[model samples]
Target: MPAVTTKFNEDDTLDMEMFEVNIKAQLDAGVSGIILGGTLGKASTLTGEEKQQLIRETVKMVAGAVPVIINIAEQTTKAAIEAARVAKECGARGLMILPPMRYKANDYETVTYVKAIANSTDLPIMIYNNPVDYGIEVTLDMFEEMLECKNIEAVKESTRDISNITRIKARFGDRLKVFTGVDTLGMESILMGADGWVAGLVCAFPAETCTIYELSKVGKMAEALEIYRWFLPILELDINPQLAQNIKMAEVATGIGTEHVRAPRLPLIGAERERVAKIISDGLAKRPNLPAYKGLSMA
Candidate 1:
């Protein structure tokens, strides 16, 4: 699953042309799903109507080839439930939801918020446990409380603690799917048994990112590592505060996207643009000739 960037026109309108192009690349790369309107998608700046439109169009374009998931990051439980409702109504196959965005809710509040959204819609849910950036860790205990909700099927493990994969498996077994949300740690996490990758830099380099996951899952570590090592510098861009600009710039390099971003967020300028440009160029110049891996076997 790629946490794909939402393409925008220079006028700040949705860039469906480029958006479809990137989505096609990901599907061709053998990704299991397409995740829209996440952090990488600039969900914060998107209007409710725009989000619904995105979900509807992506669902249509995907046409059940793979699941189309919508990210729900609302400030209130009521609004969150509404987001869920919209996702389902617009034909999203699943939802990747964050905890309350406005308030730093405690464990009880957070649990209630997540469960409320889960119960409101029949769509399968993947909780975004990105405390490193989002500031509230969904601990094992909290997951225990949430386990009874059958729709809460997966967790995007963004805690950056590799051990948490072991911990989740130890505590929940196969009850909950685990997907690494960090781009740099994708190979390690999959090797440690993460079910999938909710990737970032994948927006720019879909085949390389998916190839790493597929190779790692099949124990082809040496081949995977070669690409992963080359991919590291580009992956690091995903961790930066200006990741949207950095990755979108890379999309431009790959000819799959544009540099346009929404208001309050500007395109990369001067030194930052030059620095990221060098990384993208270097990575592409040395881009590995991926081995003829046997099968897709996507994570």
Candidate 2:
């Protein structure tokens, strides 16, 4: 599952053509699902109508090949409920929801907000428990509280704590699925028995990302680590503040996207651009020839 990037034209309009291109690539790489309108998708910058449009288009394009998940990152409970309603109407198969954005709600408030949205729709929900960037940890205790809501299915664990994966497994077992949202920790998290990855860099390099996951799934760590080590420098871009731009740079280099971010976020420039470009360039220069491992039925 990739928390996919939103493609934009020079005028900052939705580039559905390029967006479809990338989605096709992900589907071809055998990703289990498609995630739209998240942090990488510039959900904060996109209007509600744009997000709904994305959901509808993606659902149509995917045509039930895999679940099309829309990210619900609204600030208010009402808005979140409405978002969920629209997503379901637009054929969204699931929702990747974050805690109340812009406001750090306590555990009780957070659980209430999430439950309200979950109750509004029957669509499955994946909680975005990213305390590192989002500032509110949906602890195991909170997960226990949410167990009653059958729609709240999985978690995109971005706590940056590897032990949290084990703890989640030890606590919930198979009741809740765990997907590491951190790109650099993907292989480790998978090796540690994470169910999947809510990935970022997969926007640019889906083959490598899926290859690593597929390889690791079948006990091929030696092969997986070979690509992972080579992928680390470029994968580190996903952890940066300018992560969207950084990964877009790789996309541009790889001919999958352009560097046309919205107004508040201009394309990366100066030392930052050069530095990121060099990292991507280095990674591309030594890009490993992936073995033809058909573990995940990659196209």
Candidate 3:
């Protein structure tokens, strides 16, 4: 699943037309799933109604070709419950839910928060565990609390401690499907037995991302690593706060997206823009002719 971005107009409103176009591009590129309104999707800034429209439109665009996963990023359990209810209504296949947006709750509070939301809807959930970016760590112990809830289905493992991949696989194995959230560690995560990647740069280079994922999954590391080397510079951008800007820029270069971001996030200015442009442009210049990824298998 490519965790996608929201394209905006200069006035900072939803570029609904580009939004549909981008989703079509993703599907045409053969992505197995699409996740709308996550950290990169700028869900934090979107209003409830906009988010609803986006998810519903996504469900319509997808036409059940692939799973449409919505990120529930509300700050409170009640709001999250409402979001989950909305997702169920919109017919989303899965949800990537954060532990409650700000005000890092203790483990018990966090488990309770997730439990309440899980009970509110039937949509399967991928617990987003990016402690560094999100502050609170959804540790293994907290996951134990979550196991009591059946809807908590997978983990977007962005702990950055790649060893956590090993630990999670050891503990849960098939119980919780694992998808590495950070693009930089995607190769390592797959090698270490992660089920798949919930990616960002795939928005710009879906075929390449899917190729690397398939190569690594099939034990084709040498080829995967070659692509990973060229991809490292681009993947690194996904981890920074400016990812929304960085990815939008790459999308412009790749013809699948635009660089117009919302207010709080201005487009990459002067030097920073130039540097990122150099990386992406240089990458495109030497982009490899990879075999298309056909069978959509994460494992």
Q: Candidate 2 — worst ten consecutive residues by lDDT sum? A: 290-299
Q: Cα deviation in Å at residue 61, candidate 3?
A: 0.9
Off by over 4 Å in 3: 296-299
Clashes of 3: 0
Over 1-299, each residue of candidate 2 has an lDDT whose tens digit, in order, gives: 98999999998899999989999999998899999988899989999889988998998889999999999998999999999999889899999999999999999999999999998999999999888888999999999988789988899999999999999999999999999999999999998999999999999999999999998888888989999999999999999888999988888888888887887988888998889989999899999998876654422
Scored against the true structure, residue 125 in model 2 reaches a CA lDDT of 93
For each candidate, how many residue pairs have backbone atoms clashing (under 3 Å)? 0, 0, 0
Evaluate model 2: give its TM-score: 0.98
Per-model TM-score, in order, reads 0.98, 0.98, 0.96
Question: What does the lDDT come to for candidate 3?
Answer: 0.88
- How far off is residue 21 in model 3, in Å? 2.4
- lDDT against true structure, model 1: 0.91
Q: Give the lDDT of residue 274 in candidate 3.
A: 93
List the global CA lDDT of all models: 0.91, 0.91, 0.88
